[model samples]
Each structure stands twice: as C-alpha cells, then as structure tokens.
Target: MTSEDPHRLEAGHLPTPFSADEIRAATPQGRTQVVRTEPLGGAASTRRVRYVEPDAEGVIQVRTSIGEDGEDQDAPVRERVTWRDLQSHASYPADRTSLERARLEHPLGDLDCVRYTMGDGDAVDTVWFDLARPGLPVLLESRRGSDLVLRVTLLSDEVDPG
Candidate 1:
C-alpha cells in the first residue's frame, strides 16, 4: 500500500471496498470448484473437487480428493460466513500495507487479484484473491527460496453465473 512496497507500483491504488451483497453475488449456491494441487519436490499433482452450498446460517464447503493411490479422502466440512471465508487465513497479516494488486492468469481466466505475501522462516506463502469475486482465491503458492513447495489453483467453477 506504500510507495516503497516491493509488490506495488510507484503509484499505489486505493483499497477495494467490499460489501456482503458483492460477496453473495459472486458466490452462488451449489457451486463446485475444481482444484489442482502440486506439492514440493516434483511430486505428482492431485485433483480435488470442492462443493459449495448455502445453509440458513451460512455457506458450507465439502472437499473430496480425486484419483490417487488409494481411495478418495474427504476433507472436513467447513462452514463460514461466506464461501471465500473458508479459504481465508485468519492468522495472516491483516494490515493493508501487506496487500498488493496484481493480474493473475489461471485456468478460469485472466483476472485482477489482490495479493498477500507472508513469510515464515524459510517459507514464503502467497495468496491471490480474485478482485471480481470478492474473497475467492484464484491461486495459492508456497515456496522456499526459489523452489516451489506447494501450489493450489482454482481450475474452474461449475456453476454458471447466469
């Protein structure tokens, strides 16, 4: 957010103002996302499907792995105020000074994203949230030095916006 920030341009942009309606419009009920994950050291990437739905209280997300060595594994069901809340890192730095804006290209399409980078010891994790989709994460990556440790990309959304 500052001029000296390494991730931002010399001329910084204003922070995005978000509303509940914008978040709701971006996320629909019964939507599913296809996610791909690549781990460190060239390990085989894995595919996962995440189902999203809205309940009277909030949004629910259930994730299950695709083909792998063994049977499919289901991740614990998550409930959140919004679908994007499920992917949020509560412990991450919350200061606007740590935020950056970037154009991210994913299987879904080219998108404008709000980026946040955090470092812990030797590892650095970067998360990109789609600007058009409120809190939806388009990509997440972790690296040590220059070697990628993990990467997760939202490949597609099954729900049609219409």
Candidate 2:
C-alpha cells in the first residue's frame, strides 16, 4: 500500500497496515535481501510475528504487531529499542532460544505475545516479533492514553557491522 493509502495514518495515527505479501514485496525496496518469515503465536487483540533476514553473517530479527479492530480501544504508543536493550530492560531475550524459554516459563496463553502494563493499568504495551519476511524490519505498536505509537526496527548489519 503506497504512502497515499487512506488506511495509512498521519502524524500520531501510524503507518498503513500491510498484509504478509505486501510486506514481503516492500522488502527489496529496503536494499536488503529478504529470506523468510515466521509467525509467532500468542497475541491478545492483535496479530504478531517475526521476520528473519539472513545476510552474510547471521539472521536479523524483525518483530511485528497488528491491531484488532474492536479490541484496540485506546490510542497507540510507539517506541523503538535494540534487542540488547529489550533483553536488559524488559526481560526480553536477545536470542531466540532464551525467548522461547521465557515463553514456556511465562506463556501468554494461546497468544504468542506479551503485555506490559505501566502506571496502574492505564497504560499498556504488547510486544511480538514477526519472522515472516526477511529484510522487513521489526514492527512494534503501543497504546497509551489516546494515542497509538508504531515503530519499525531495521537491522543495520551492512552499515554497522560490529
């Protein structure tokens, strides 16, 4: 869906929603090669997945989130951070094995997502990874107060090979 799509949000609204195929198509535009995609189950009021892109070295992890029409009541709150940061701060694992272990230890029921509530349940955030498409960056959306925040995390392996 081009940037002109009506479903595309402006300002604080959020980007337009794209299907798995659409996301895959856009991967090439990012200049990186897309390898594969895998869906991560366990989500409440939304769908989530992890996009895996492998380059010369390792695979890049991309997380994604899609809101449920009726389920999302509040506005969106967006934020971005590295896997290392998520691991250090939010108890998210930097690696897939650790993440899977955490999932088994603290399952989110049938949903493959985790909900983090802040400030007396008035603010809530849910996180999931989309491994469905390579080259596609990780997608994150947060809802707080009357605004919805959306974030896309791209892997800069080529530019920042560390």
Please name the candidate that would achieve the greatest TM-score relative to the true structure: 1
TM-score, candidate number 2: 0.24
What tens-digit string does per-residue lDDT give for candidate 2 at 101-124? 112112213223332223324443
Clashing pairs in 1: none
TM-score of every candidate relative to the true structure: 0.65, 0.24
lDDT of 1 by residue, 30-71 (tens): 666667788876755555434466544356665666556634
Listed per model in order, the count of residue pairs whose N, CA or C atoms clash below 3 Å is 0, 32
* Per-model CA lDDT versus the true structure: 0.60, 0.32
Residue 58 of model 1: what lDDT?
Answer: 50
* Candidate 1 residue spans exceeding 4 A from truth: 1-22, 42-53, 68-91, 94-97, 160-162
User: Superposing all C-alpha atoms, what RMSD in Å does each candidate have to the true structure?
Assistant: 7.1, 16.8
